[model samples]
Target: MNASLPCVLFVDDEERILRSLRMLFRGRCEILTTTSGSEAAEWVRRRPVHVVVSDQRMPGMTGVEVLREVAAQSPATMRILLTGYADMDAVTASVNDGEIWRFIEKPWVARYLVDTVEHAARVAQHDFALAVARLAVPPPPVVGNAPIAARIAVLDNEGSLAAQVRDVLPAAVRVEHAFDLESTLELLADHDVAVVIARLSSTDGDVADALKQLKRLRPATLAIVVSSLRDSRLLIGLINEGQVFRFLLQPAPRELLRRGLAAALERHAHLRAQSDLLQRHAVDAPRQEPIATTTGRLLRAWRRLREAATLRSA
Candidate 1:
């Protein structure tokens, strides 16, 4: 196995499932398979793995349990959950406790699985490179001496949702509500917004289109999508087209909302710092653009596939 190739570890109780995954990902990555969660955890501790995909329901230890351990053991390794069941408890645990990068269902399409893993690998590589770059340079000064209160925008038609978000956010953060895409754009232009939380489906305008425009206008601004839509295709579209920082299910718990907002603010600050550092060190520091990765292309393809499937069914 080439040490340079990205490593992926797949864990499942079923031997056949592990074998199938190994065959699917063979040659594309350095694949490691194990039946026991304990063994998989130990393996990750011993070696560097870029990603881990685990089944939710195992004999003694569950997938969430294994992933939680992996998260602590290898924080840089992206975790993914594979399950035949979509129990709410498992889903919540996967998000809250496991902090999984992606939740994939069982009987997954081969192409989709391959695309998702490839994308996860690219993201892992990019993040590792960024960490190395940060260490190579001295810390830059604070980006701007803006006000103490960081501005946040909630782009939702419902007043109640915005209110709930505002109530949960910290006192240091100021929240503004925008009922439509036009208003959201104006608000962003007028304020140094750190984060924008928007509904995935909005009556005002196309939410994905609005987010895309927002990114173009303010590359550093973080986007969070709140939606009840369970369609994988639409969610994938948001990931590829909107480049959302986080996804919050509709009627999100107050604690979840708070944590998501805090993380987004922290990310915004880090981005600003990086930008400032580049500008100071390099005379002509070019503006940064999101990487066009194979993952993104795959996501686009997945969206089209879903749409076609839906049309045929209709």
Candidate 2:
């Protein structure tokens, strides 16, 4: 195995599945395969593993539980969950507890799996660099004035969950509710929303789609998903595609919601400050030439006619 290559660990209860993954990722990365979730966790604890991909339905310890332990032990390592079943409870737990970066369904395409792992490795590298940079920089001075309150947008199909979110957030933070995706986009366009709480319905993919668009428009805005549906695939889509900041199960505790919101606001401030700093130091380019004035345009037109007549006569 190449010591320079990124180390990737694969965990599953089935031998054949592990064999297949080993073969698939053999040359691409330093692949470590294990059939026990507990063993996988132990390996991560001892090794400088860059990524861990585990099966969800392992015996003794489920994938979520194992990944959660891994997360606590190695927060910088990227975690991926692979599952045959779309158990919503387990999926939500994996996201909320394990903080997995991506979820891959069982019987995944070979190319897709390879691509996802490569992408995860790159992200892990970037995050590690950023962590080092943060440690090197001195903390900015604290402002004396009261901090600006973040504006939050809550989107729910029936408008009930929105009210619940609003109740938990502080009174100083402005909270806006939208019943559907279209309204949510409009609200985002009109306001500089800092956080989004989306309560998803089982039948509709609108909320997920809306969140994707929201990320494109306001990449710094933090997104929190609230859902009762136990579809692992849907949750995976939200995690991998939407890049949600947090996932909360339905009927969430008020305290939990409040804490999540507070953390999200802090993250938002950090991201916004970084963006502003980049803009401030960005180099200015030469401006485009101004458009022609009315008198200049007339002069140019007269010159063209005289030049045309001289050429025609010659």
Candidate 3:
């Protein structure tokens, strides 16, 4: 593909591996390499690198630690972990804690390595594109009884949901709550909340149906489905297919629930407010139906919208 390749920074303590990668991918991308993690971090701090591929077996800090730092600083930059099976725990931690997009074996083939890097570049570019989308289309408005609040419901056969709601959200929220999906949706339909905290039950209820209906009814509403099941397949399905905002494990501590819900709602409010702004901007935006192209049709749409926004701002 003739896509604009992303700037890549490859970090490893080994000079041979660095040289080999340089030989293979020198012309493929605007490549940057560092033999030390400290240098790599500094390079990242100084410039806007799109993607970082790092070896896990560094001398001082593991790949996970390095990427964690990267995630905190350059969140838009994609991360990848390269390692030769020294520790499975580190690899897993790298994937989870660092949010590393991909994990590759150390003795990778030149062709495979190239493909992996290319794929990561695509992902990094997508992340950047999504950031632009967020800029172009403002998030939805934040409307609620509480100035800063969350709409949380804990599904219980009894009124136990009240406890969950209280435990999760602060006093800033006016708890419009319920025990099941239907009641929750009724409250949600009437109220303006950034988040819906719900629980799953299989003894006599279909939790998936509840989640599906909520998403169908309110496309912009963010659902945080909680389940105590051994497997979170249903929650994952809702998130993947139904476009539910996020999911949480059931039996999570009340404090954890509070923090997670607060965060989810904060994001929800922010996205809504931004979306409303974008919608308002679109009123006089030099409108276009849609573009037909292979490369950057999506990005072009965003660029146009952002252009409109720029015009309005100016």
Candidate 4:
């Protein structure tokens, strides 16, 4: 209805189908219809399309191909795969590769289409904003005390909190003992830390991204953030995008830390379990770590990854 509202690109060679869908979604969204995938892609490149609904069986590029391109170029855009013909390989590939949020089958119901698009739009907006904010937010920096595996990584800055964590967590929790930036990275190479305990300070966007990148690399790890500054927006970014588990104010109570650690350990176990399941299924896509974990691993490991990534990028 609103011209300034978010755009949605619908691609299907079938004019009848396009017309029908347009009729259905005309008033609800700012719909742009195209008869071909290439046309859809062009539209997407030139304009900001919040969501893309493409027919899987397009003439030139299949729906997956179009959506995949959209994902690479404009990841903030929500992607949807629509088809009358459904197969496992195609579905899985679209899900894994294209990262489509929802799949709609043809002979689509008017109500379902509208509802699905609405939900996808909400997800897209929320996810993108959170991701942007996470650039400033830190992920939690602690996993758990699992004796089954050696403490490959330890994320404790040189502080009383670190000592406090050392006292409470499973003795197996490895300690990198990095007081500043440089030593933290040196420790990362030698060990595989499952948990990180970062002393949070107000830093730049790059810092938060560094934390998020580590979690992406090692989804099984935990990131716990201990901060004196409780910025709610930054905290939300950490929790939503950075995958931080727990939030503890500076000078956290020992009992609270103890309880949080226990929960974190449990979350770590669950992540491992789910990871094992995905591996068993032989899924190629990286499954996101659940947000329920207590905290992410510490700052040193988190920060070093960014430093390394920056060096590589440069």
Candidate 5:
């Protein structure tokens, strides 16, 4: 195996599938394949694997469980879930537990698969280097001259959800309520929000689009989608495009919401401390607005301004 090439692991019960993947990435990556999820995860713990692409269904251990173990053992390694079936439970579990970098549908385009894995490998290299550096000389938690209260923005038309989120979070964590897209944008612009809890099927606008836009502008701001919508395609979009931190069903238990918010806050703080990792959460810019209205143009300009500010700061 070439040590210079990025290391990639593929997990699948099918021998032919593994063989095909090996052939596909033979020259480009240092490829490893396994028919068992447990073995794949053990390999991750034993060595530095830049990327892991696993099929969802297996006889003993599923891909979600495998990726979850890999995440616990080596978080810096990027995860990609591959499956032909649209198993909603598997997809949701992968997002909440595995924090996969991308959800690639099985029978994937060869070119697309190659490109995604290559990109993830490069990012994983950076992440591993940062992890090593942090271990050697860990930076203190991000704080300034004065304590800045991490803001949480809730984009729910009903005041009830916002109130619920506020009640669970600490008093020090300010929670802002936004009833519509305009209000949400304004709140995000004025405050350095650490987390965003939004519905997928908001009445005011496409909440997913708003979340993607917000992530593009503020890469460190983590988003948790709490919606009744149970569309696998939409969830995959959130994973690939927005890189949403968590997804919860509507009317989630208070304790669940609390735990999710706490994790988001911790992840937010980590991103702030390691700003370079912000690139991991970058989203694709919307190619074309659903409508070419003034609001859309305003959003474009707003995004441009935010990008300019980010560059100047950098």
Candidate 6:
């Protein structure tokens, strides 16, 4: 292996799978294959690994558990969960606990897998460099007890999600509600929303596509999707394309919703404190397919927002 190639670690119980992955990523990355999830976690702790791709159904520690440990040990390392089955619990845990960068299904297209790993490696390298620089900087002084007032948005056709957010969050946090794409874009344009709790419509892809565009325009603003939709593929798409912070089932439990909101708020604060950290949440570019009517209108609205901002500045 060349010493200069970006390092990618693959953890799967099957030796054949490891061998296949090793062959796939041979020339592009410095491949490290291990069947033991524990060993993979240890490797992340001991060295500078650019990325870790783990199988979900491993023996000792599940992929979610391994990625969670990796997150704690080395947050700069990009994490991906590659599994044959779409285990719902694992998928949810991957979002809430592991916070993986992408979820790739098994029997993946060879080119797509390679592209994902390469992108992750490049991102990890930048993140690791940024982490090192932060260590060298003097820490900021701790502020007083006053909580920073921030705005939250709820993009749901119905008022339920907004009401839920209002009930769960403190009164100090202003909650903005938007029922349509135009309104949502206007709200985002006017306010620096720290977190957005958006609904995923079961009937259309418009909501998901809008969320992805929002992330691309504003990486610092965290998004939590609350939906009744149980499609694992859609959730995975949100993870990779939107970098969605969390996915909550409809009628989310109060405590879980509260915890998710708190986490999103804390993450937003961190991003605000260090803008460069936003790159860690970078999402993949939108798909090239033709846009739907709703999403096309959304694009126009977003363009108008940009024009207004530019005019104000000028």
Q: Pick the candidate with the highest lDDT.
A: 6
- Model 3 per-residue lDDT tens digits across residues 169-254: 66877666575544554455456555666666562354554455444444445566555653433432343234444444556567
Candidate 2 structure lDDT: 0.71
lDDT computed for candidate 3: 0.60
lDDT of all the models against the reference? 0.71, 0.71, 0.60, 0.63, 0.83, 0.84
lDDT of 4 by residue, 202-232 (tens): 6442444445555655556666667676465
- Rank order by lDDT, top first? 6, 5, 2, 1, 4, 3
TM-score of each model, paired residue for residue? 0.67, 0.75, 0.50, 0.44, 0.91, 0.90
lDDT measured at residue 204 in model 1 versus the true structure, 0 to 100? 28
Query: Lowest lDDT 10-mer window, candidate 4?
Result: 277-286
- Write the residue-wise lDDT of candidate 5 on 1-314 in tens digits: 67788899999999999999999998999989999998998899899999999999998898899999999999888899999986778888988888888899988999989988999999999888888888988888655321257889998887888999989987878889988766776677667888999866743356777677667678888999898877888888778878899989888789888888988888888887788887678654554443344476556646654765477468
Error of 6 at 283 (Å): 2.2
How much is 164 displaced in model 5, in angstroms? 0.9
Q: Residues 1-314, candidate 2, lDDT per residue (tens digit)? A: 77667888888999999899989988889888998888888998897777889899988999889889888887667888988876778777776777677778888989978988876766665555565687979557434211366788888778777788778766778888887655666666556678899887763554665565445445677789887776666666667666677888788788888878887787677666665321111111112111122245433433443354345336
lDDT tens digits, residue span 177-244, model 6: 99986888888787778898888867365778778877877888899998887888788878888899
The candidate, 3 or 5, that scores higher on TM-score is: 5
The number of residue pairs in model 6 that clash at the backbone is: 0
What does candidate 1 score on TM? Answer: 0.67
Model 1 shows how many backbone clashes?
0
Which residue pairs clash in candidate 5? none
Clashing pairs in 2: 88-230
Query: Residue 153's C-alpha lDDT in candidate 3?
Result: 50
